[model samples]
Target chain A: MNSLDELTHELFTFFNGFSSWENSVIKTSELSVSEAHAIEILGTHGQMKMKTLAGHLGVTTGTTTVTVDRLEKKDYARRESVKEDRRIHLITLTQKGQQAFAEHHQYHSNLTEQILSVLSNEENEQLINLLKKINAEAF
Target chain B: MNSLDELTHELFTFFNGFSSWENSVIKTSELSVSEAHAIEILGTHGQMKMKTLAGHLGVTTGTTTVTVDRLEKKDYARRESVKEDRRIHLITLTQKGQQAFAEHHQYHSNLTEQILSVLSNEENEQLINLLKKINAEAF
Candidate 1:
């Protein structure tokens, strides 16, 4: 029987390796992982408050502020204050940001295609099911 | 039939959520995710050169340099010059680093226990197999 420590260590190692692989493969353009993630959330959800974006990104509002600042400086995202509530800032991507997000999306597709090319249809279904199960547990 | 773009978007969302969940769960003693990862690699493979460490971290050597600088500043790692080749710098974790690694390992164990609490033995085995299959395709 494997010790709990051994098993957990193996899992952590696997998780880290998987994350590193995804990061390496998906990292293109000038975006950091967090930056790309911020873009992704914006692209999918459309415009959102900084706080909402931060909540989705799982970062503090302060961290989100900093990230947004950098993105804005790069012309990838913009912060627009609501006319009704000036204190609330809405963040949206620029055309350039949308282009970047689209390219990033393509990167993900190519990666998935590469993985799918190696697995049978049954394995693909199994993979998706397993991921859903794990994610459900994670939540 | 799912378009390649749609499939990729789903895959990216799945993995992104997974990564966020894992990050939220992993505990560290004054260590960020990157710092924890670097320490873990050093703990597993003691005394590696800068380039080798960069390769293990799946990051550029310049990035590894910055990570090492932070670790050394925190007294968790130290750099030693190779006698045969003085230009080569080997990075090894300090005793404090090892302690931190142990604590981090415990964090991972706690997380796994939490996850396993919600999974049956069969489900656990299935999850592992599915992850392995997906990872095999990732490379």
Candidate 2:
């Protein structure tokens, strides 16, 4: 049996490596880390309410509001009020935001390819299966 | 063969789940995200200078200085001058900080156990070996 300590160390080491790679990738762009995260969520899931964005980002609505505000100011995103309920606002990425999202996603694909290159075909399938189980149930 | 796009989605979904779990865990504490990150590094690696901390965090020194300042204020860490090089200062975790590290690490172990329960013994070993390879080469 692999000790919990060994697995935990390796898990965190992997997380840290991914994090550092992400931070450096964001640094080369104009978007802040939080801003880039918001963009990713919005891009992946399409337009969503502020509350939903906050939930996805695991941040407070107030924090999401600030991030959305910055994105709007930078012309990367916009908040539109629903005609039926003016109080409810849905956030959408603008053309600029979509472009950034595509660029960022390409980088993610590149990284994924890099990771795939290091593993065997069977290992890649095993990894996907393992990650699927963990993602669906663990968290 | 798993397509790159499919693997990319699963990988990011897994990453997002882990990220959300971590943020929520941190939210229950007094430490900010950046501060908690710094403590994790200092606690794991022991004392280090400001530049080294920033490098590990993949952030700018200015940003690190601000984070270290907050840590110092909270008495979670301190900067000590080396006698041989008065200009150099190493950041060390205080007793309180060590206690916090232990607590946070326990949360991580709990999470790992939770994840382990969802997989078989063979799967667990496979996971460790796969993570080892990825951590060694993927990032």
Which lDDT tens digits does candidate 2 get at residues B1-110? 44898888988887777787898899999999999999999999999999999988877899999999999999999999999989888999999999999999999999
Residue B118, model 1: lDDT of 69
Supply the TM-score for candidate 1.
0.80
User: All models: lDDT?
Assistant: 0.77, 0.92
lDDT of 1 at B119: 75
Identify the runs in model 1 with alpha carbons over 4 angstroms from their true place. Answer: A1-14, A25-27, B1-14, B25-28, B60-66
Model 1 per-residue lDDT at B59? 79
DockQ of 1: 0.42
- Worst 10-residue lDDT window for candidate 2 chain A reads A14-23
**Model 1: per-residue Cα lDDT over B14-123, one tens digit each:** 56665776577454257877888898889888889999999988878999999999999999999998899999999999999999878766766777777677677876
Over A21-138, each residue of candidate 2 has an lDDT whose tens digit, in order, gives 8888999999999999999999999999999999888779999989999999999999999999888899999999999999999999999999999999999989989998998888
Compute the lDDT of residue A90 as modeled in candidate 1. 95
For every prediction, compared with the true complex, DockQ reads 0.42, 0.83
